[model samples]
Target: MKQLIVIGAGQGGLSAAIYAKLKGWDVLVLEGREQSGGKAGGIVQGDYLLDPGPSIIILPRLYEAVFAAAGRKMSDYLVFDKLPTISRIYFEGSPPLDLPGTREECLRTLKEIAPQDYRGIQDLLRKLGSVAPLVDKTVFSRPYLTSKDMLDPGLLQFGLRFNPLRNYRQMVDRWVTSPLLRAFFYGFPSYGGQTWNSKAPGAFLIPYYMIEDGVYFPRGGVRAIPAAFEKLAKELGVEFRYNSKVNEVLGNESKATGVRLTTGEVISAHAVVSNADKLSLLTPRDGDPGWEPSFSYFTCHWGISKTIQGLDHHVLVIPKNFETGFEELYDKRTFPTNPIVYLNAVGALDPLAQPPGKTLLFSVVTAPAEVKGIHWEESKWNYVKSVKSELRSAGIEWCEDDEEFQRIQTPSTFAQRDGNYRGSLYGPDEPHRLMGLFPLGNRDAKWDNLTFCGGSVQPGAGLPMVTLSGKFAVDLLSTR
Candidate 1:
């Protein structure tokens, strides 16, 4: 078997290792962390186990496909409980709206909430349906290698189905009339750390997936995702070196040889697949285009003695001034003073997540990588104060006396703990133009045996997309 080395054992790295082993390659996964899953791992505080990283599991099929491709059953390795109510959104001075798993149920909820705008909601769903096929068929399935890939027939089909001229926000405004509903729709861009006005095409499908296919929770926790993949990789004879960080990619002028670990140990391989952030490994060239970093999170995981009523598993608290909140995050590059909060509780799906009669509240507020003129060291407490205030306003009133455990993780923490450049959740936001939708490819054209995966590279961010990125890297390497 030809030797292959993979740096970082996150979702993408684990997936790549599994695939590479199946292809008859000797694979080794080098991880800087104590365990796998990168940002998608879980933490335990006393009796409560909290998944502070990725709280939502939108697509289970992607994981199943990977397991199936490896000649295994995903259900045997992992258990997923599909959510009926995807998210319950709360807006200031308005009644809370629960977004159901099925489109029909969601439409009924919309009709009940806003009788006059029911027809417009129907139009919106129809438009989303037309746009969704293109997404499932073309965008998500493959990587864009060159400028020529943009001209692929599937991309042309996508353009013809959806309006090529109108941006995502403009398209949303065409059908959604209610102010609260519009605010709810705009937040979809945040999934990729993009603004509502971004011209990114695939963002329109986020709400569609949540409503149509439904959100889910792994039986154990989010950590179970990587745990299953790691288990598969180990069974396939792929070796993992936990806490062994790769110091550098050893390569000649045209091809990568292997890697040198921080412990002064060097391992050689035929190809190197880096699942770390691209910026952490590669420096951009002069003529190459530059992009701003994606928004990172300031998360608070609270273990409370009691659960709050009228709150679903997932809830979004939209700000009274939602636009300004986003502007502060992406445009101003500062903490959102009036931030939208994504608060989740997983106790319903997994009782082990919290103690009996106790609940875990995992809250995330979007923050910039580097706040202008302000250091997170001095300002993170203030941000936590703001999020707590927002939680109170949204009706999750808990006492300090009842709190069993509390820990705050900011973007700075990500940089220090996970080696993420500026703690960016995703690499960069998708460019709004048709050409911009094409992210950086998996393989480096200049370096033959060097490839990249995870959120920073092509087929961009989120759990499912990064999982696909790993497979795409192997596919590209295998063909070469």
Candidate 2:
């Protein structure tokens, strides 16, 4: 048996491990964290359950592929319910937009938002219908090793349905007339820690999944999906070692040979795959500084005493002064002290997410990676106070909003726990010019017997992209 040692236990890592085991490799998963699932992990605060990461499970078929590859069907392994309405958005008095999970319902709801914009939305939806196949044929089928994979003339037909050349921001600006509606539609790109303007045109598929494709919640929580995978992988002979952190990637003759753990065990394997933050892993070996941090977040995981009136499963409250609010966040990177809020009340939608009479909200807005070190130290607490005031000022929060159980996640917590590159999420904004070549395959990447996967790599970010990245890695190894 060829021993395989996977260096991380994130969604991509776990998926790779399970698939590798099925392919008949001797698999040993070494996770640095106390548990698996990486950013998709959940937190249990008293009786309230919160997943600060992964708002809703999109691309059900991709997740299904993960389960099936692990030798277990989703139904047999766990119960996941389809959310009737994928998510509901609050545009304030403009009327709430419920992103229903069916095609007809979505079209209907979108028409309600804007009758004139209906034509554009329908055209965009038709464009999205072609995205999955385009991805499979162009980027997903092969690793992004050469410039040709992304820019090949042959692949241009795949992008013809939608103009990948035009900036997405331009598209949104042209397609939607209402500022509130435009912001709501563009929120999809930013969902995965990316900006609509910076992300390629292909990301329009995000909303396609949200409304037409559907969203889901695991019967237990997001953790249930991985826990089931862990069980099934063990059933098929994959060993797991929690708290076994890899200090370095051992190499011989310029090729990876094994890994060195913090406990001093050098576990050699025929193949090595990393699902950890690729950017972080790159820093250890190269002795270089990353470009700059991506956007950081200040999230409040509040367990409200009772559900507030007029709120839905998902909410995006546009501030009375939207431009000023965004300028503070986009230009200053401060806590959007009074910025528009993106909120999700999971318990309101899924009872499994929280105890009775409680609501779990994942509220976050843009902030700089580091808080200027000193200035924010003085203003940190005050900034949070201001943020709270802003939320209530927007009329989304009421008198009892803060009285319930509450917890907050800051940059410091994520920095130490997740070892993310630069404490930012989603990664270094896809590097304007590096979009073509930079952040290429990790120097440690091996093709003969080893492979790579994850958001930082090609085919890009998001659960589906990363899942597809892992699947691509498995295909490479199996072919060899």
Name the regions of candidate 2 deviating beyond 4 angstroms: 151-154, 162-165, 323-337, 366-383, 398-404, 432-450, 478-480
Please write out the lDDT profile of model 1 over residues 135-224, one tens digit for every residue: 767767888877777887877776776677887778778767777777777767766666666675567677777777888889898989
Top candidate, metric TM-score: 1
| Candidate with best lDDT | 1
State the lDDT of candidate 2 residue by residue for 1-480, as single tens digits.
988888777777777788888788899999998888776767678877677766667777777777776657878876777778865565545555677878788789779768888888877777767666776566655565545445764366665655655666777777777676676665554544555555356557677777776777777777776677677777888899999998767776646688888798998888788776666665657664646655666677777777666566666666656656555555555556465666777775567777777667777765665545524445557655655665565466745545567676666555667766666655564452245322334224433555666655545555666767676666777775
**Would you list the clashing residue pairs of candidate 1?**
none
lDDT of 2 at 340: 64
**Number of backbone clashes in candidate 2:** 0
List where candidate 1 sits over 4 angstroms from the true fold. Answer: 283-291, 429-434
